[model samples]
Target: MVQNGQVFKILVVDDEMSMRELLEILLLKHGYDVRCAESGSSGIEAIRSDPPDLVITDIRMEPVNGIEVLKKCKAVSPRTIVIMISAYASTELAVEAMNEGAYDYFPKPFNNEELLSVISNALRNRGEEQSVSDSREGLLYFGCLIGESAPMLKVYETIQRVAKTGSNVVITGESGTGKELVARAIHRQSARRDRPLVIVNCGGVPENLVESELFGYRKGAFTGAASDRKGLVEAARGGTLFLDEIGELTPVLQVKLLRLVQDKTIKMVGGTEEIPVDVRIISATNRDLERMVMEKTFREDLYYRLNVLHIRVPPLRDRREDIPVLARYFLSKFTKDLGKEIHKVSSYAMDILCNYEFPGNVRELEHIIERGVAMESSRIILPDSLTLSMHRRKEQERTVPAVRSEIPIENFDLDKHMAEIERRMLQQALSQAGGVKLKAARLLGISFRSFRYRLLKHELATEDELKEE
Candidate 1:
């Protein structure tokens, strides 16, 4: 495939001449620069002379095997992507190839379309990495948000376009996806940059006090009002007011908020006059406001008034390509904050993170990296430092003991081995349940008291967990 007027080169290595010719024709038809290697030895020679963008090689070959060729290619050019194809593919071989740094493995008689898609994605990821590497701090970082993915670029463009105007904006996304950061970016780029940007959590304020809290109360308006006080709306004059979780506003509060949005005016509690306020309204919500309006939970008029412009913050799973960049960014931030010298995340740890589906989005990733930095005793963060809740971690736990069981009796120390296994299981259960002792205890099929005892025994419980109990 071609990118930026440069054709991607693919090297196909196979012992069979027909297989080599077949792949060459298939790749060449798809507008790629195809090169053929008749054997693993030839593949290594070709890679040394000129490293291609990607390599597709068969696993079995006489003398020099494809695994050896993979090692040589990676050693020669670490950025080169390798895909292994074999007729005799097994779980062990596939796992071995992956652990040895192969990008992906394909069994014989694989779907042509699937292979093409995999190649496209691998090259695209490499390109994205190259782009981010070129201007890491400048290109990808927008205010507090960090990402170079297409979704984020769209969000950035929308922010810039809408920031110049005074029109209302509604940002919708899942929680922890950085909707507030988008609001901040818009405010920062607007004409009222120097003015105060007042923030109000619509859901956090008490229903009884929300009206007075939003609109100022005149002197003796209520029992506690000894004098006139400006509310959030008035305090944000000539600036912007950010309403977070706007969906949580009660019907009465929604009416007051709607009045403010409609006429740029607000009425103080127990006051007779309407006060004009020249503040731009920016609202954010994790709930679906459209659905709320249809259900008559949120006012329809206020929905349109606030949603004149819309922006959706993409979740972390949708932008997996940025995980490494964000991980490194957080690594740098936490390292300096904690006064640590940790430099990077181990390759396996990063792989684990990238493959994970972050249900809590970017905010969760930030916390993960911070914990990794704090937990790591070495210069690099390893898989053990990452507290992930993925099912794959459970699978890994099951596989570990099986591998350990195969260790020679002479080399095995039963006490140490048993202790290690117990420590890992406790940590895994705790992490999976997000450090909730009761849930973790249930996962281990034990009582809370027993779980607490085991945690103390293994030193796996955090000080916070202990204190909470």
Candidate 2:
């Protein structure tokens, strides 16, 4: 039985002495209890005697190859993680290993860091799998989003049910909960899979310019409108028009949008002709449109039109079961993209991630993992590698009280103090909004562009900071 913080026992099975020795030394250096077997048959004997927590085996062993070793390991101890290594890596072999339940496949001449990362991830996953109930083991993935929790399962079901329909969809969720991904999934699964999915950020466009941006302008529609421009609605002609941050649209634009939704037609900003658009509307927002309707901030008619087929995505905290899986998914993604060797988040780091309130949701988690992968020199991302906003919030909470007690009226710098206040407020809003700049701006009663400017002014966070949220 593995104890918390105790070294994990790893079995290395390889006919090549150098490979076995190298892995043994590496595991030992990393504080793992390492054992080596010269052949697959010996490895199986060792497993039968006492199964280690993980097995690393090379393919092409004389009588018993890595595949057989993997099978025998599973037969002996189902919980043990088996990783296959091969000098001649092929698509077929990789698929075979995965089909046979290998934790991961590593090609020969694999980067040492990458190998270690994969080992760490496998071990972590094994631990998680052991703890998780069998019913919750299988997670369904749609494009980029991954989850197996009940809420996510329901979401998957809803997506499958509604994807084939032409009903307008309204996806509501806390920012970073992957609303856009859901929209794309719907479009992909829908009959319009071949057509373009036109996207328009309601909050990203200027208030004065949104109308023209959504409903294209003819030449001379405005001072800068020198040529006929196709609006987003027209651009989406036979496909889907994804309206992100739908609640950010001005009241005037909302009325215009209501018309488009009611009658699949759009009038160009300057042109008199009403162009018929054959687009399926899919809008997403983090705002409560119903509440906005009650307050008269959002038109009730528009809200009704857009809410025909609603999908409310649960926040990250609401689906904690998915964190470990998502973390590993992101770890694999960033590691491969960066061409880095980092493979896994340490169990401690994973705990921290799973426990921390991800105000920015999946997007925030992705940023955290990306940073961890970039900064971590070791294969495993430990707790220290994670720079959680919760820590920063705690520090702010501690320091604010002290500052309040110590401030003097005589030596006050209003400019600096106000700027600091603004920065802190912005940070708090971002945290509350789950690292979504548009949502943060809305929380602050400001425009998205202004919020961006403030972020730049304060050097607080970057545009990349709110990526995909």
Top lDDT: which candidate number?
1
**TM of each candidate vs. truth:** 0.59, 0.60
lDDT by residue (203-224, candidate 1, tens digit) is 6334545676689788888655
* Over 4 Å off, model 1: 1-140, 388-469
lDDT of 2 at 332: 81
TM-score of 1: 0.59
lDDT (Cα, tens digit) per residue for candidate 2, span 141-184: 56656888899989988988789898899999988999999999
